[model samples]
Target chain A: MNRQVLLFYPLLGMILLGLFIGGLAYGAVPIPLDHVVDILLGKGSDKIAWQNIVLQSRLPQAITALLAGASLATSGLLLQTLFRNPLAGPSILGISDGANLGVAAIMLYFGGTLGQFADWPISGYMAVILAAFAGACAILGLIIYFSAKVKNNVMLLIIGIMIGYLASSVISILNYYSSTDRVHAFVMWGLGNFSGVSLEQLPFLGSCTLAGLLLAILLIKPLNALLLGEMYAANLGIHIKRTRILILLCTGILTATTTAFCGPISFIGLAVPHIARLMLGSSNHKMLVPVTVLTGSCIALLCNMLMVVPGSNMILPLNAVTPMLGAPVIIYVIVNRKNIQYFN
Target chain B: MAMKQTSVIKTSDLSIGYTLKGGRKKCVHDALNLSLYPGEVTCLLGLNGAGKSTLLRTLCGFQPPLGGKIELMGKPLSSYSQGSFSRMVGVVLTEKTNAGGITVYELASLGRHPYTGFFGQLRQEDHRIIEESLIAAGIAHKAHNYVSELSDGERQKAMIAKALAQQCPIILLDEPTAFLDVTSRIETMVLLHKLAVEQQKAILLSTHDLDLAIQLGDCLWLQEKGRPMACGTPEDLILGGAFETFFSKEGIVFDPGTGKLHTEAPTVPVGVEGDLTTSYWVGNALIRNGFKPSLVSEEYVSVCCNAPNDLRILFPVGDMRIAESIAEMVSIIVHKS
Candidate 1:
């Protein structure tokens, strides 16, 4: 690693830490910065409301944002590397849309109840989570099957988009048939937010994201080899089919779990990897992967913080705030794509 | 050509082509016998759709063969695992791939992937080998440059350097020089030839540049649609009348005497005499202008070294004409004849 790359890690660390702290301090009820830190350190604030706000509400949201950011960004990076396409992300394969479809089926059709289908009763959140996982995996399996049959990357990508479109149309149909209140609830979920996953739900989301991220880290060598294209990567002893399957599987797990809990947060996966690539100016995957992880966390936290207004409590929808932050970066990257180095 | 030394790779009765999904076989060629020797460059030449690329891909284990056997260094080609197979063969392709923003050193280091550990961190010894490979490929000066920043020729050299870093005994290239400029094409061929001779690495390449292949290839594999491949030394193929039959087309012939391809078949024979060097060019002008020039024929077009700029054209009807330049000479011959 060069001096610049080495220096970038610490800078990213500082930014992530700063944004995380800001996420805790700035909320609907604005708590002082020091009190938020003290409350986090277990020294309770004088106001129990402040204590509950910091330790209970803001803490889970911040951690969820950080983990989701890393997972989504890593997925995006793997897909980008695998397909050699700049635009690939966790949602590109329609895994997130599949999750959305599952949630739609449960929330809209069954009134968010699994009790009618099975003997064992399940909560609304668990039902959504399980259904989303099942939906995402179903689509992931379909994509993997096509991936095995289709030799070309661009063709596989087109097939994935076709599958995504299929899932999305189903979601739209479900939404149209549901009651007004159920439809409103479904639309709220679709709007997306970082605070949806509770303190209790963090364990499942956290472990899965960490495992996916670990698998991604282990995949650095193969991912680097893949940057040269399939022929050379095969010549370099990489099993192209196996590597591709693993990448899709990892991206599926991350996108499904995050979309299930936190809803379908957009563009972090699509934009953060490029942000790291733009900063690092290299795509070796060794540095790009870890840097992508950190950069992802920082940006997600930054976006989460941007949701809360400083003087007042007019919090914006995550979907609205996300596109505002991410679209310009994407446009800049696109317009100046020639100046940026990606695939050789 | 030397049979005593063991062959680097040999195939017997090998058939190559694609097998469709419904068990329908699309056989390109069958009953093929070919051998590649260490310290030699073997060039495969064929018209489009003749399965030259398929053959190259098959030999390197990229495509499965339709029938028969291939032995690599006395071992069955299929027996080696991907890891072991990669150690023995290096492949370079002409197709443009994802040119990622990686430095030349990092790109070259990827050649060590088969040997590297899980994380693929390079050791000091691997670094030394990478440096040597860069030097050998003649891109050592641009070792730090991004792969996307390099020109096509430089990028090709970078890829060759990575293959060199593999330390593989055999290198298979599919039209390695197909996309290069003339100078770079010759440079790449010469570089491969040098590697073959100096490193004793068996090199096999398929190319469309017949002139370079004829000059530099130690052995040539000639393929035509649905026909068995013809393999031999370039000299033997030329002398045994294979070149004439293999590449025969209308208004085109391979001249064995001049060792060049010509696109003209002149009718009336005209003999050439005097300055030997200038006479060669005079003959070229005559053939192109619909007159066959001969060194020892009844009719003659005389060129004198004393007056090198002067050319005298003798017509069959006892008419003689002297022209100042080749263009003027061609004009006079075109109008009168």
Candidate 2:
């Protein structure tokens, strides 16, 4: 690593640490910073209720926000590089739409309920997660199959967009057929929240997102090679087809895990990579990927904190809060594309 | 004969074409024998749709030849694995790269992919090779600049550096000069020539710039549809009249003396009397203005090139016009006629 990156990480590390702690201490209930630290250390809190809220609720929510943000951001970076298109993201590939389709099937078609099948009662949360995973895997499988058949990356990207449209069409149909109550539930889920994962669910969210992040780290070389474009990458002895499949696998895992837990959170996957690129002034991926991961975590924790700035009683939907931060970056990128050194 | 300068790449009775899904084939060229020698620049010149790119793709093993065989270093092309093939041949294609945000140094370092570890970490030697490539390609000054910030010529040089860093024995380029301006085009050709001699690497490129090819190419391959391909030294090919009938068309003529193509135009005979250099340019302007040079007196318009920039045209109608330059003389003579 170069000196700039070495310095960049610690600075970002400090910022991320600050955001993580800030998310824990500041909420609607107005818990003191000292009390939060004491509760974390298992020293009895003056108010036991505040302790439970901070430990069981705010801590898990903050970790979920951090992991999900990093996953989405890395996924965005991977997809953007793989397609050689600046606008590509996890949602652009229709993987998130696939996750939406899964949730729609559970909430809209199943009428907000899960039943026993084969004398086994499927829990609601596991069913939704499984459905989302299945949906994402299905889209990922289609992309991989098409990638093998189509030698052109641009064509594969087009096919992915078309597939995403198809999934959205199916989701629209499910929403149309559902009752008002189920539709409301589906809509609420669609608005997106980082609080869905409880204390018990943090391990699942953390492991899956970490695994996806690790896979992205492993792909740093191929990703950098791909920035040269596919033909040149292949000339460098990279198996273009294998690399494409691997990229889709990584993006699919990250998007699916985050969308499954957080209800198709928007903009983070599409915008964070651009932010990281602007900050680093490079597309090298070796340093870019790790920095993107950290920046994603910091942004997510900040957004999570903002969601409750109006107080716990008036929580902001994450989907609403993210676009405010993410959309402006995208607009700036589009407006000053020629001035961007990396944009061609 | 110094062992005839061992061939880097050779094709024997090769047939290349496009094969469709049902095994149907559309043959572009057939029965071809070609060889590339080390320390030489070979240019493949052809008209559009004449299969220059197809031949290049086949030679670099990007696509398979329909029939016959290709050998690299005396081994069948198919026998070499991907890793060894990359180590042997570097390719520079004409596709506009989207390698924005990547510094020139980083882009060149990618040529070390085949030699580096799984993560592509650049060792001390890798960095040295990359720096040397940058210097050789003459873009070392812009090593830290983003590729998108470089001009077309600089970007092309950067790509050339990347290929140099690959350290392959042979480099194949597909219309490397197609997008460059005249100066950059000649500079690129010169660079390739220097690289071929200094590195002793075999360099092959397909181009439509016949003038530059004839001037700079050590050897040439001329291809045209429905005609047998021609291959030889540029002088030999021109002397053998290979260029005269190449892509034969009604208004275009190949001048073997100058090794350039000229539009076939009607010329009126004119007598030229002056200093050799001045007369030569006046003759050129006359030809372009549809006049032919002749020594005849009657029925001929005489011209006097008094100095480098002075010209006097005496028309057949017994009219005289003095002009300062060839353009003014040609205009006066043309408008008067």
DockQ for each model? 0.68, 0.65
Query: What is the fnat value (0 to 1) for candidate 1?
Result: 0.64
**Each model's RMSD to truth, in Å?**
2.9, 3.4
Candidate 1's residue-wise lDDT over B1-337, tens digit each? Answer: 3454688899999999998999999888888888888899999998888889889889878889999999999988999999999999999987556655889999999999989999999999999999999999999999988898987788888999999999999999989887789999999999999999988999999999998999999999999886668888899999988887777767678777565677865667666776777777877777777777665443544333224477777766566777787777778767765
- Write the residue-wise lDDT of candidate 2 on A37-150 in tens digits: 899888969998998999888998899999999999999999888767788787777778888888788768876522221122336566776788778878877866776698
User: Can you give the lDDT of residue A282 in candidate 1?
Assistant: 92
Q: Spell out the clash pairs found in candidate 2.
A: A342-B101, B268-B292
> In model 1, what are the clashing residue pairs, if there are any?
A343-B99, A343-B100, A344-B98, A344-B99, A344-B100
Interface RMSD of each: 1.4, 1.1
Off by over 4 Å in 1: A113-127, A141-159, B2-4, B274-277, B296-324
What tens digits encode model 1's per-residue C-alpha lDDT throughout A110-201? 87422222222336566776788789878877876876688677788788889989998988888888888888877887887888766767
* lDDT of candidate 2 over B1-337, digit per residue (tens): 2476989899999989899989999899998989999999999999899999899988877789999889999999999888788889988988656688999999999999988888999999999999999999999999998899888888889999999999999999999998899999999999999999999989999998988898889999998887778988999989988888884477887866456577874456778888888987787777777777667475767888798677878877777778898888788877776
For candidate 2, the clash count comes to 2
